[model samples]
Target chain A: MESDRSHRASRRRFLGGVGAAVALLGSGRRAGAATPDPAITELPDWTRYLGEGVASRPYGRPSEFEAHVVRRNVAWLTASPESSVNFTPLHDLDGTITPNGLCFERHHSGVAEVDPAKHRLMVHGLVERPRVFTVADLKRFPGRANRVYFMECAANSGMEWRGAQLNGCQFTHGMVHNVMYTGVPLKAVLEACGLGPNASWLLAEGADAAAMTRSVPLAKALDDCLLAWAMNGEALRPEQGYPLRLVVPGWEGNMWIKWLRRIEVGDRPWHHREETAKYTDLMADGRARRFTFIMDAKSVVTNPSPQAPLVHKGTNLLSGLAWSGRGRVKRVDVTLDGGRNWRHARLDGPVLPLSLTRFYFPFNWNGRELLIQSRVIDETGYVQPTKQALRQVRGTSSIYHNNGIQTWHVHAGGETENVEIS
Target chain B: MSRFLSLAPALLVLVGVLALALPALGQTRGLGRPALPEEIKAWDIDLRPDGHGVPPGQGSVKEGEAIFLKQCAACHGEFGEGAGRWPVVAGRESLVNENPEKTVGSYWPHVTTVFDYVRRTMPFGNAQSLTDGEVYALTAFLLHMNDLVKEDFVLASDTIAAVALPNAGGFYDDDRETTEKHFWGTEPCMKNCKAEVTILNRARALDVTPDDKGAPKVE
Candidate 1:
């Protein structure tokens, strides 16, 4: 009886607070009579009507209001859609995990639609037993594991190497995505067919028309590699190599062959067109750097950026993403004055190895111009370098592996633009 | 003795269950069957720099020119100079320029890459449709266009390796750990990192970024 009395007292207090707010609104309206907010006074249509029943959409979709959140592509970036890329809308997302449908797509000859039953993964060359396994056969193998990893294209920030080119982070840094994958460890599969003594490298080939191929060291293949078929608790999307794909953790996205068809063990690397003509980092001295696999520590402020501008004047929350291919992110630093001073930003959510980490910094804005930036330090104590520092050594020619600090200039009127601070 | 006799029945049942489960676990270990030689041949198409997987075929520059015009010239241009935004396959621009034109003659290191790329994924949408001889012909024509071979040169599986291009020694293994690591100090500057900051460039000035309507803002 005493607890019920206290609850009634709290209810009365809440009602009194609402009545006082209305009375204040009435007194303020004496200057110029204003219409009351319909949203606050009248019930919305949903309150008076019955909504759709369960499973209206067999697979649930995002609310219609969120239709603008989507993958975007730069039409002039490449020649054709078949051999092009589309970026994830990073500014529209939250947390560390990128939704499966929103993951960035990089295609050589477009998405291949393969029937799982007819598709096969052939393991040959430098193996005791050359095996061909169907999709069902792979599932029966023991020691299945689920892991979250970020796959980044080597040329993620290629355009920004010279200067700030892309306005939105979606175009500048969206050639990446992180997802939880369910699959068997590659070590288990390779062990099933015993490796030959001479095996030191392996070639991963895709089943798409491009038949994309990349040679990987056997030591890495035996390490944290996976043969994944499911992502985010569902079967892989066709655009992301539906039946199966190779997951070379902590390496360039090109090494992760989609629609994986074959694995050939060898004693040396195959320098394909991707490794030679493309993906190589060209130096100012006219020499190119080959086999630069690991993506270094990098971070970017998603909010107060070009697309997502700071509108509120009193208080605001700044958020962004940071990650490293080598390991977990140890700390993230934010700068509001373009590197004059740095403050530690709170790293939120689980900081998994080779996965995206979310970070936030709360600040009170006073309607002043601000230059915003973020930097990440990985577990290995590697610090994200400044754009000038990277250019001092590597030059502006290299189109791949540009992990430099990005600066966003926020105006007093709440408009933000991508800028390079010197 | 009476207590031991009561537990014997339970122990016997446990032993029976282990015997039945052991074989099923063994079966799971060996999941896939051994692939036949024919199946390997159908998919093993990748080639190495040493010409390890080069198929036995030969094509002359004359024959290659015909195939290039009919099959590949629509996008690659009549003389492989690139049409519209397609890749220019024959030029050799300076590497240190503001915008380097890296073509087959200027950038590619291996001759086998030409053969492998064409056979595997060239003709854009109609990939792997070319016969092995036609791919060799296309490779020969590309070499001729790059001025690496004579018009009468014939590229065969055995002869392709002998042909070498410039910039073969232009690439080195990644040395960022040694060359660029010193720039990344353990303790980055927190206060007074720079005396003053000025905006050097703005993305809006270029106006090349795509608009929200998904159209190029080039105009």
Candidate 2:
């Protein structure tokens, strides 16, 4: 890795020398101002040597050169490694969808390795024919739903609730992942059991040691929830609930129970430990806001962030992600002078509802210091609020649901840092 | 409105439509068999604030303290004050100012949540190993430590709901749909959105963010 870094440094030095020569040749009329000829147009090592055969890596992985792209966790964030969260490298990823391997992981009692043969999903309580479904039995049901959705932890930017705390988008906006899930509709499974008239809530429980449970309203369970077994075109990675999981669209990620084992139909919410003691957002006045499920619209500048610094002064493509738990991101605006001026950024690729939407803005840089920010408006006409605006209402007491607009300060030396501008 | 009205021209046709949909409402295709009694008993372990699913057993505060020393003291500390970030459970009485210390005595809305959580995921590594009697005793001990009950108090399924938490009224239902309604709008200010913007805070100034090269240890 060190050698690769040095090689990249030399290549940059070579490019700088060649560009300087070309500029001198184009502008000067004096002698000895001509650009040098090409150094060596010879074949590299690959051209003379035999390459490795195809099956050398039957299941291929990323090349060694890209080793730096990885999920990272702050050691000081939690006490134990078992019950904590690791952030996704959002600044390193491109496009809207997060790759399965790079998705951020959060576990309360560590990941559970369950045998699919022994796993059973028991649906009881207010139902006509309460049933237990094995992995195979669940696949036999109809009305399979495949859709792309962004799952965000309610505490994605929780650390920054007081002020700008994390230096990179990977830490500020990384506790989220957008993926395509293939599963049967949760409504179909509930219908098979015959939901009772008074059934207004469903308690989804995990099989992990924590047995993490969350009470979901029945209206949402019937709306867009899924009994997902596959994600990103393959079986769910163990870190993200293997065998079966509940996909609660637009709700807080905790409600999307992983390693799902049982769901009980009930007339009222269970008010479990998760919903009351943990996920609830405390207000400034001492009273907490309970069951705040939807993650509001949020956006951030990816490139020229703390990690992905600007390296050149010419035209540069600034890209970032915008998403909403309410609906699709309709428009994204980029601000260069700390919200003093703004311009519409182009939305790239598919703009599906409740999914991550990519936005880009092209700008010619002259190595001047600037404050960059991005604001998103979702389909429901909800405008992303500033940190000041959110703080006025929620206060710094909350450690969850901090979806305030993020600011990145770009220095003249071509480095960036996280900052808050008022 | 006309498109939908044109389709339903007659009352007889509406009646016929209703007849077809009514049968489909309660119909079950019998794809999966009925859940056996034993299977339901195994997974139906959720308890509610109303004391719905607490197992029948009794445990005194004295019994709970003995069990806590053996099973939980390694992590929760001798007095439930918590050991090395392992969640403090008692004696947060005076820390309820600006930066509140949210312990079981001052924060949890429901005691049933405590009972249910401990019964299902307690002792950290050894979960669901505590008997019904032990869980009741632990509940009794926690209540005693919080001063909600006497040292000789005993907790059981029938009387769990009668015990109230100190901060039971500390929470309210979500009102974001109304409280934050002003955030929803058709147009937001673009040009001249702010004037004389100044930097309020910087992560670099705080210097808490870790180095980017720290590799995550995945289990």
Candidate 3:
């Protein structure tokens, strides 16, 4: 059967080309070889209506496919790429702000541009009022509020206490974020500068060319602090400090000093080499801790983890992210089998004050091989440890508090591999 | 910041890995490319040390002593000596944590951060396009090459805050209390984490290491 007569003569030339496209659809011709209306292949009913100018947004970004949510680092640590710092993706992000182009940067003298209407913020020396303002005079002063927090980066787990290293959480847990912020409360601009009851330390400083300075404490600058100018709402996005900065929520984000400028109020604590010898911690008894601050209570599960995987396998979710500079996160758990049996996890939104909450968990993979891990806790009940209980309590001569608990294996065909279960 | 990862329950969870590089939504990606602005317009510059964001151009010290003897005294030796070996912009004063090396009018600490670092990086072979009177006569001949001021003195932006930096009050601001209540509780473990689950006994088990300095250093 000569190949079944060439498949019945190519099925009668495809049914004689479908009967000349049904006699060219009533003979007006233009039917098959005319495949060119694809500029949109569909959708143009006023672009499926969501218009009427959909409530304006003169500016605000993210969702151009998240442009890879940027700010990364670890170029062989650093020798100079105009001083360094770049960490901010926090597992593809979710909920609590952090979007001004993904936040986390830190430069020492490079990214300044500084023009916010010729910027100013100059508070100057021993004040009774040595003013300068503008960024619209500190957004026209007045309580302002918004809050939410978590800043972190006193070297968030400076490369594990000797383990897991980097394999992505965008370089492990991406520095830190959690946003909300807006501005002004630095105790009503240091009580409008006139509180000299022997001042006791203020020195802020930062106009950048490495003019970076610090030295706050006067009771956390009269508690809560935030000369900010807005984030998650607008304005301040010249790399998170356009016309002012100094939020200090949950501590350590280079003591929150970006493009800001001068403050003074002094009495002591100036030692600045970014706190003598780069964010000091070097211990193991050779002595070196200096004001460790506090960001503690950690957590991490981020989808299957190594950059996420496992797609279709009976219901799953297992999200993550938690925070703690001292308050919210009350409970996170996770442990798919690492700390041997554990669960809980829901959390989600407003876990406010020094922010970042999120958490989730649902599970049911069945493809086998997992291990996960999370932990957190917080609301003044700090939990997150393991890395063999933080190097058996801080020993391996520290390198800025490593926070700990983070694992994720997952195999069974979905991949992902950062491992550390013991 | 944020380097500790660990991950192992077979392979560290970060599932589905779309690799977040977002920025692409529906189509048409072909226009011979070069408009670049569907958004991104922030542009920061930072320049403090007191002159804050300085970008208007003003340098002096008599046109910065003829462009610091024509682009910084032959590799900075006509007085910034330390040449052939470079650096040595004059001896670092008290040498703060008394170092072993480094000088720029004695361990820098603000003179508007040496005119915002020679108006944005000095003649390290051209940077930020200097010239505010040759960065104020090479910051008044490096303040007479560190004896601080007077070679007939002359730095400008109206005297760069009467120049007084010697680690302008060194620095500090972390006031530690790390959210007390013992850094927010936990660590109780409901019951003996099995006497802290003993581990001891690894003796090196590394991989992926390649920090490439010469491409070799193993166990």
User: Clashing residue pairs, candidate 1?
Assistant: none
| Residue A345 error, candidate 3, Å | 9.8
- Regions of candidate 3 where Cα sits further than 4 Å from its true position: A1-72, A76-82, A86-148, A152-167, A177-185, A195-209, A213-245, A248-255, A258-261, A264-301, A307-317, A322-345, A348-350, A366-412, A416-422, B1-219
Error of 1 at A131 (Å): 0.3
lDDT of 1 by residue, A61-139 (tens): 9999889688977666666778889888888899988999999999999999999988999999999889998878889
- Candidate 2 ranges with C-alpha deviation above 4 Å: A1-40, B1-30, B93-98, B207-219
Q: DockQ for each of the predicted structures, in order? A: 0.45, 0.35, 0.03
Which one wins by DockQ: 1 or 2? 1
Error of 1 at A287 (Å): 0.9
Q: Specify the highest-DockQ model's number.
A: 1
Question: How would you encode candidate 3's per-residue C-alpha lDDT over B116-145 as one tens digit per residue?
Answer: 556555665355476555665676667666
Task: Classify candidate 3 by CAPRI docking class.
Answer: incorrect
lDDT of 2 by residue, B41-137 (tens): 8878889998778788899999999999999988878988776556667864543255455678877889899989999899788899998899989
Chain A alone, TM-score per model: 0.91, 0.91, 0.34
lDDT of model number 3: 0.60
Per-candidate RMSD vs. true structure?
Answer: 10.5, 8.4, 29.1
Candidate 1 vs candidate 3: the lDDT winner is 1
